[model samples]
Target: MSDSSTLPPARLRPEAELARDALSAPVLARAARLARWADAGTRVDAGGGLVEEQLPAAAEQLGLSGDDAAAHASEAWRIAVDTGLVEITDEETGTVAAGEDLALLTGGSPQDVLGVWLTALEAVLADASVPDLDDLVDAMAEGGEVDLSSLDWDPEAESDFLDGVLGNLYLLTVGEEGPGEAPVPLPALAASVIVPSDMGEPSNEVLEQVSDAMMRLDDQFRLLEPVGLVEYQPVDEALMADADEEPAAPVDEADVTRYGMVRLTPLGLYGLRARLLDAGFEAPAVGDLSDKGADALLDGTAPFPPAAAHAETELWLAGRSPLDAARELLAAARGTDPGAPLRRLRCQQALSLVGAEAEPALREVLDDAELGGLARVWLTEHGARDVPPPPQEMVFWLTIDTVAAQLAAEGNSEELRALVEGLARQHSGFFDTVWRVEHPATPEVLEAMGRLHPDKKVAKEARKAAFKARSQQGG
Candidate 1:
């Protein structure tokens, strides 16, 4: 994903809760156990990996009994050494000792423990990018060093592809229309990166690539699950028994999940969001604006989806008095910049949540040149009596401003088209009078109305009025 794109905010768990999860992750937990077990007698090769003689003992120490136990122990030891949970005391003697970060796991704050987990996560991710040992062995050159070209593995490309997949998964989880908290099917997730979005039908070659990608991801997710990044249901082993057959497309909901299903755990969400922010993405989370001023709240949430924006605004208003919050929103809402209309729209939405106590604040701004139309609308909506009707000029100005705000907020949407048509039908001479409004966006709004109105005569009138508006503004 481009770093400049703003992602919908992730709803993260508290650091304390996430830290508990990080500590309990199988990989990090085993790494910690192996770290504490290391002492002066623990031998290591020049690369700091535990020597072959030590693997069996290390596996037994962890109460592991399996053909893969030695491999698992070695992996954990690598994590411990990489994350500073174990340190080699002397390269010549091959002696070892518990490292400083081991203490942090038990004695440090929640953030500190999570910091260690992030380091281990990075190590595992790097491991996941390397070709499997069997592949390397089969591709070995005469001198025993692996030939990367023969193996058909591009280290950087593999890493980038995995990163892109995780990024897509993150977007799926946090997106407004996505399957929030539900496990995404494996074939669909694999297709997201491999398949072109606009493609009508996949050829045999593309379908084969997707099948290969699914198999690769099944292995990757299995490796990743121990680090607590995802909760995964592995692709059923029965499907793998016949290598010649293409995996069947899931016909029903019951059959789909057997292919594989995966979702990010809450801890995974926090980890991925941190990585995104580090890479310069504007990844916002709910409550980010709670303590900010009213101006920040309005402008920062200007591009958010409607539901997320409402949730953020409610958080911002939670601590302030209704009158004070309403007054602050009104002050921030007064500007002539291009973004001003949307800010005012957001201000109106915020005021609606402020209720009857903000009546005085709304009444206070009824005489404001920029805010008067908005204040009057708020008062009338809340059932206040004796609210003076807006002057004719004010009504025209408000119409232009409201249309400008909607244009900014929703673009040339069907709803905006309907509103444009409705306004032309309701007013006998709206185009003639609206052209004279002194609002900065008047010409632009009129031009939009000209395009949106379906009636030929009314559309022609809107274009002429737009021309008049531009001439009056001398632009």
Candidate 2:
């Protein structure tokens, strides 16, 4: 219930924990300075996006070249926006200004500052390295998850070309670590070599270009260390004896360069996870469930979106027997929590995926009114012999409950809205009949749709439908 700053150390310290691995002091200092300038009402040049022209002014102020100023502004602006030092209200209209969080950050601890900076690091990478990263991610994902390892090289040895640079260390954190293999060191030169518009194996010249890009990026990465997005060290303490000086490198390329194995740190892994979610990627959080049984899996996913929970359930059930999986799911759904209704809904979905094998276990609950509706739906959908239809009210209520469960999960409201609106249109007197249906969540779902539907008319209609449904129940 508390903010990250107020919470205890053992209770989910994502920012502090992640910042430990990266070099973040410089980034935090720059972000703080940018925030102070914003408090004085500074702008990133109101005319023509400012990097080419106004960067010189900023450079003179910061004692750097125009190009360095541009790079600093590019990174610092993104950090500011992400950490609430700067807020971009409208990208199209170019409306941006300092934010309320700037003052809070000014007084923040080093961990807090680096944590906020880490939060914005993903967006900074997207701006600098992968402009169309969003589209590429959409193309890369399959069955609600992204798997770079699954991709085949196209007659060129360009395996994980995008993944190497843009794929990031997030995958490394969540993915299966190879058995007995060392931390496969990815050097600085190997870090670059992007294809620009194409994906192919690199030539010697391409390696040089990629190496150059990595060198430039290494500068930014050094500033990133305290935030923990990436890690590099001197491999000796005396090398960086002066705390204010930039850390010295190994100075030899054959074994290690100034920047050591510059891969995504564990902290960077989670930072990327958050960033991916913000951009609408269904990044998986399937942590170490490889050894978990059906009971453990169901217990863990009780509150997950049905689609996400179903995917996890199937994975858990893959090595086990379907009937057994169904039994375990049904057992977990029998919890007495106030949230049991939605939990049962997700469990039923997983049971359905187990197919007709789950019917025998489901049928035992058919007479219990609370769970019988779900059982009836499963039996009817699975073509069980001699299964009689439930009352008209039960059918309608169950349909509404299914929609309610999806709404609870916050999955694809656009599709849900379209489906609900279509059903309302198909039945001309939708509200009249639906209001009379006896369902506990009918009013709640309708009210939610009223607020969530994009169209004013549809939203208003949903509100009216909810009022009528409430009145029918005399509420």
Tens-digit per-residue lDDT, 282-321, candidate 2: 5546433435865566556655544446556666778667
Collision count for each candidate, in order: 0, 7
What lDDT does candidate 2 reach at residue 240?
45
lDDT of 1: 0.92
Query: Which run of 10 residues does model 2 get worst, by summed lDDT?
Result: 2-11
Each prediction's TM-score versus the true structure: 0.95, 0.41
Each prediction's RMSD over C-alphas, in Å, is 1.8, 20.1
lDDT of 1 by residue, 30-65 (tens): 999999898888999999999999999999988898
Candidate 2: lDDT of 209? 60
Clash pairs, candidate 1, are none
Off by over 4 Å in 1: 244-254
